[model samples]
Target chain A: MNIPKITFIKMNKKEYILIAGLLILGLLSYFFMYNIEPGAMVKIEVSQKLYGTYALNKDQEILVKDSKGVILCTSEIKDGSIRVKSSTCTDKICIKEGEISSSGQTIICLPNQVVITVINEKEQIDGVLK
Target chain B: MNVKKLTLIIISSIIFLSLIYFYMNRNIVVAQTQFIMNTTIEIKLFGKNIDKQKLVKTMNRAFDIMKEVEDKSTSYVEYEGNAASLNKHRGEYYMVNQDLIEQLSTSIPFYKLTSGEFNIGLYRTVNIWKNATDKNYLPSREEALNSIGNSTPDDIIVDKFNNRVKLPEDMEIDLGGVSKGYALDKVIVFLKNSNIDIALINAGGNIITLGTPVDRDYFNIAIQDPQSINKILGTVKLNNGQAIATSGSYSRYYEINGEKYSHILSGNSGYPKHLYKSVTVITNKGIISDILSTSLFLLSIENGRKLIEKLDYPVEFLYILNDDTIIKSEGFKIEYSQDNLYKDE
Candidate 1:
């Protein structure tokens, strides 16, 4: 009976250097690609339209309305957080959602079809369901 | 090794590193957002296996359907097919859109389910509060009290055969509490019809999930702390076809001289209920969750629990008290973070 012998190939300097470079590249990609910044502004949308985008640093009130000119709600930006101050809609659920400061935080008014979202320097999160 | 073999090894190594770079650069989650139903609605889906174009198209369609629901059910808008017109023609029979009929019909049952605690016919009472809050003052006690019992849920007559409805002369219809949930339900139906199961529909504080996300056993949701809006006291994990609706006094309140008056008025008292900081109801039905959340906030915990026990659908409750105490139903599984000082009841 004859047995087949298995042998290990020795890696030279070039192969070792190439493998080390690949490992470093992978680590670099992981850090650079995954880093995300916090949200800086709150974007308000009413009925599928861009109502306005307000800086989180500024304190102001944004009166959001539907296309038909009905004032749906008032959004107040204060202390880097935005919240629904008042709404003509009966449920007033959006007002109850309080303020959203984080990048992925959101406040939605279903009755008014109003959506308010927090956005970072870049749109980092996949989606925000609030 | 020969030069060709060594060159091949380097080439393969380069290819492998580039593949890793590309994989890392690829988006892990795909999300789309639209302004719908007077709120910002975001539909987020996980996994790269989903068809991006189809999901986008489906999301847009869901918004359109939700808009239709909103338009039909909105009491603020006076379009030909809207609920405002129906309220405007309260004395006589007014032909309404099917969506309006369905929403109103769906909500009427909740009135009885909550022992008249969840009344949509309190439009007059709501208007009084709105008018008062608009002027930066609380409504006169007499005016608020007078608005109470002005109309009952029975005042709105639904004529199914004629496809019309009649409201009492003094009565008005406001679907504010139920319409959002109804819209969510309609959107869920639309998503299911499109063969998209793993989706979450969040209409403001009302959240509904169609199916669990691809990577997780359950969807984790943060319950906003009433005292601190940005921080969450705890999280609730929901399975497929589940929903959570939160009603709180802290959300829509009138602050006069530093006193916070919640907008969640009791149907019986005709004034805002200040017992709890917030009430969250987790259930399968959107409208039910919405109604129960509001009703539970309006009622005492004992009454609220009795109401929940009578309902056929299973539900869990969580209430954040004014003192930051957290009370939860036996079945509600909430994991509070170490930083939270709220005690569980």
Candidate 2:
């Protein structure tokens, strides 16, 4: 069997610190970033397809469709988080889904064909659903 | 070194190693995964611009798959798609998808339990309503009466002897509730196999999420308040491999005499019902998610709950009653937001 090269190059202090800091950031982000509460809205779009006008709820629901007959989606603003609620399609995939409180979260509806992204509508979210 | 110093040094090294690991995995968050269509269509994956032309194309492909099933399964379409193939063998035939066949069969029982509130047939009746709205032509009273109630599910045969569907000529099957959900399932599998760890698929209005949010464990979903168009009652939290589907009367309906009739037709009346305002079902199965949402809407809240209880499908429910009382299943604990726009009841 052939052995590949195994070399250890010392990383500079800044490089080591930067890497360590990044790992801590990731771990903290993983455990603490999304302390989810139910019915948090992640994405909101106004789609005309569901009803006359529909509103997206925190359970990824949409209660209203616009008067224009398009499903209107808007993120539910709450003290906790955001989500996509109502949509204009027969299948209610959005409503059954709960909430994501993370900075970057998203909900997509393929039927009315909309995407709800969680961002700090007040401040930029830490990540994107993408 | 003393014991305290030794422990501190070891912990520091551990932290340093973890840092290097995270740095090495940096680009994974933004990496673009493969896009697939039902293993039958191809959709591109781009995190940016979900409405972009490419993403739309993928969505369109998912629609195509839905349409294909509709074309094949719906008696309304006239062209014999798979639905016809399955239906033609109704009584004596057991379908390869015993799961689908069984779902329909059990759903029939639900309709019976709901006093035909949740039906599997009535394709002919469905046509009457569809034509009434689409072509501005309601079926003749005689036509409406004759087309429906001709064949009960008991009369229909599931021929296990041969994989065929059979029904009285007057009666046809429509997978309206399950078709889109089925399509969602297949699409998710396609996405998963393509090594796409994270994705969201919406079939018409049904949404299914695979994997976690890019930066969160739970995905936030909104629930529409029944009375208001621009309001949200609450939100649902979703984790990896979870799906949410809602069925409400607010979306598709025709109004008559100051009364509203939704598209969720009543199997018995051959018209829509004033059941609960809406019912939302959360489960992992997209097909079940779709059917149950529609089915529960058509069923009485008690019967729907009974149906859910009998099944072990990891199901939970939320019901908005006719009186607008919000009822959550014992299992349901969706956090109510501070800005909850609608009355919980």
Candidate 3:
């Protein structure tokens, strides 16, 4: 039996360079791209049991609640907007409806005890009316 | 040869390790540029802290939504005849836009409840204000009153079964006053769902707040002196989830002969009133706050007080009178700081 000759497969110079370059670039990009996204939430609490509803477009409803998870207000989403649809509160005022789609727009619950609003990861507020 | 191989390997390894380190920190080094469309409105928000970037984005979106409504609203003039166009011949019915039909039907109830004070069917009158080209100037008394008669909210016929609207001969409907508020409300919802912490969306001075200020003792919002917008009468402290809107003669008025005509004209008189120089309402509902702000400014103080008592939605009002005195409800708090450079009545 003739012993088969074993030969080393030498890597080509260009190929070696290419592989090294790609690995370095990929690793660098991957590490650099990994990031921590900022996140924050603002919680609006109410002292009274205010009945309210928030509607997106006077159609879709998002219910607002208290810390105990009791329903305080409902919201409706419409026309890419949200507003208070109905409330057990005397005014049915929130029911007169408003629109809020961004974190800044807010509706409060007066009777059932909740304040529903939007905020961000940083508690930094930008402007005041004064 | 061995030394060269070792040097090459060492260089490669060093390069590889450095690349890994660079990659790991890439996010921190590269600043992501974003295009944020921005618009600003001066409005009073109750009990919320707002972030600047979030507020700018919301305002931009709010303007975009306004354009959307203008395009889709049935009351909108179809520069091009399309599905959303309103036709008068259907006895108050026309092949209307689904969106417009729905919004009108929903807000129409408010018009009825407010006895047309909150009517969206003031298109004819609003057009008079809008159509005023620079050379055209504001309409003469006769012209202002001419087209206004046709705008009776009762006459705005919407055939629910057909989902259409029929306007009277000379009347039109305009949601300009409320649309911004409506847009502000939607942006609020968007921010909440995204779990943003604080923000303010102001569209041409329509203020909506996202959260209470972390630094403020309270959301210290100023109520502008209607007579002199640059001068503020006082500030209100808000803690959470409240919206404040001000309807003042100063916001939109045609100055002629030193007499100011408020943008909020009486649909009845075809003329603006000087009942109250400005009215600010604080509430959860932006639309209600916007409308009531105007209504209260136009209505008698007695009626205004009665309205607040009826609603009692934490609406602290500030009325700047023609006489230069301020009228605030009993529970209404107007915080005046010595630094706040304005005199309170």
Candidate 4:
């Protein structure tokens, strides 16, 4: 049987400092990058334009109108979740899409050309990969 | 080492790591939304080294293709290349566009596949219901039954060589269910040809995806509850190149005397099927998924399973009953929330 000798090189002072600095830098970046301040607001867009941003904490009913001032849909925010109450669009698919409370969730009414999305500081992923 | 030398080395190291971090985050997504085909068309492109202007141009072209498909297939659009022309020139070989020819040809096979339950030729029946719904009334059974004529696959003749089509007399075609899927397929092909690797196209209940997200293995799709519009039934993770279509009675229905009449009618009775609250089908093709969703909604679980089992590929399905007992196919790997009562049947 052949015996192999293992060598252990002690880390130098500069190497230790560099490793500590890199670890701290990584931790700092991660803390800043992933510290998701839970979304406090819901943004509504109609016809590809920004409609309005409403606070999630507030309970209110918003009448989403089109460019011609025609009331397209009514959105209600209650208990931190927002849902479409009614819509003038024939299908009313938006109303059936249900309520969305989590960040990065979206409710889209195709017929009315409306999109309701929840946004927070940490939520940047557009959609889940399929 | 000297203090000045140590500080300079640390600064240089920080700069090098910053460059690496920036390089690692180079991948970005460019998304655009447009209104076309009676719905919002949103196209997203995920890539690192992408031509922004070229991708936008491709997206515009994709929208134009959707508009073209809508024009060629929709009975509502009264254009030169519209499918309504086939109805107008019924019993005669009317010159039609290639798009209409493709749309009709692709959908005609499904009429047989779904046992006529998902018929596109019932435009008259749909019109009667629409008129009645608009007036807030229910259409009579006799009126609905009389409207069904020459609404089968055999009645619609496709003269492929001459680029013409002939429909039976007094018959009108409605591509309401399949048009969105057809348009989605067209847009997806255009995107693929444009070298777009990852994209998602949603036309209301008809959704089609091309590739996986840059960091995810699958896309998360939530199915909403029909009884309660404020809740979701479950979440389905869709694989790459998969399509899902949902058919439900919750929308596009009229209430009369506390009873609901949905828009999806059955060829057997010419009345909307009231069995399931919603049916969602996941398959390889959008048109197949769309037709199957409607067909399954009108069918019993045993019959629906038999129909799907005969197909070449395995299709996953989720059916939510009126009583909220969820029934899913064996292959359907969906995660339901705590509120749902579900089992893989």
Per-model TM values vs. the true structure:
0.68, 0.58, 0.55, 0.70
Q: Which candidate model has the greater TM-score, 1 or 2?
A: 1
Q: Give the lDDT of residue B188 in candidate 4.
A: 83
- Which stretches of candidate 2 lie above 4 Å from their native place? A1-130, B1-64, B78-80, B84-115, B134-146, B159-162, B256-259, B337-341
Off by over 4 Å in 4: A1-130, B1-25, B255-258, B341-345
In the order shown, the candidates' DockQ scores are: 0.07, 0.03, 0.11, 0.04
User: Across residues B1-345, which tens digit of lDDT does each residue of candidate 1 receive?
Assistant: 699999998998899788766654343344566776666777664333355676677777887888888888888889995788988898899899888888888788777777777778777888887777677787777787787656678678999888899888877878888888888888888878887767777776788888775435677777766777667677778888888988888776767657788877777667887899888888998878888889899888998888888889899989888887788888899877668878976
Q: Summarize candidate 2's per-residue lDDT along B170-263 as a digit string, tens digits.
A: 5677667666666667667766664556665543235677776554676666666666555666666666666677777775565444455677
Native contacts kept, each candidate = 0.11, 0.00, 0.26, 0.02
| Candidates in order: C-alpha RMSD to true structure | 17.1, 16.3, 20.9, 15.1
lDDT of each: 0.78, 0.59, 0.58, 0.77
Candidate 3 C-alpha lDDT tens digits along B1-345: 499999999998998787666543332211111221223443322212334455455545544554564566434456332222553342445676555655556466555545555656566666676566333566676776776665466777777787657777666666555655565566577656656545555453456676754335446566665555466566676555667788877777766545567778766655677787677777776666766787787788887776666664677777777776677766678766444543457
| DockQ comparison, 1 vs 2, better candidate | 1
User: lDDT tens digits, residues B1-345, model 4?
Assistant: 589989999998898688656544445566777777666667776654566677777777888898888888878757785787777777888999987888788778767776777677888888888788678777778888788864576678999999989888867888887778878887888888888888877666777888876656776676666666667666777788888888888855766656788879987557788898788889988777777888898888898888897777569988878876778877888777678655444
Report residue B292 deviation for candidate 1 (angstroms).
0.8
On DockQ, the candidate that comes out on top is 3
Q: Where does the lowest 10-residue lDDT sum fall in candidate 2 chain B?
A: B30-39
Real interface contacts reproduced by model 4, as a fraction: 0.02
Candidate 2, A1-130: lDDT as tens digits:
9999999776699997998799678776655444322332243444523222222232333344555655445445444655455545667776566554553565666675565555444222221111
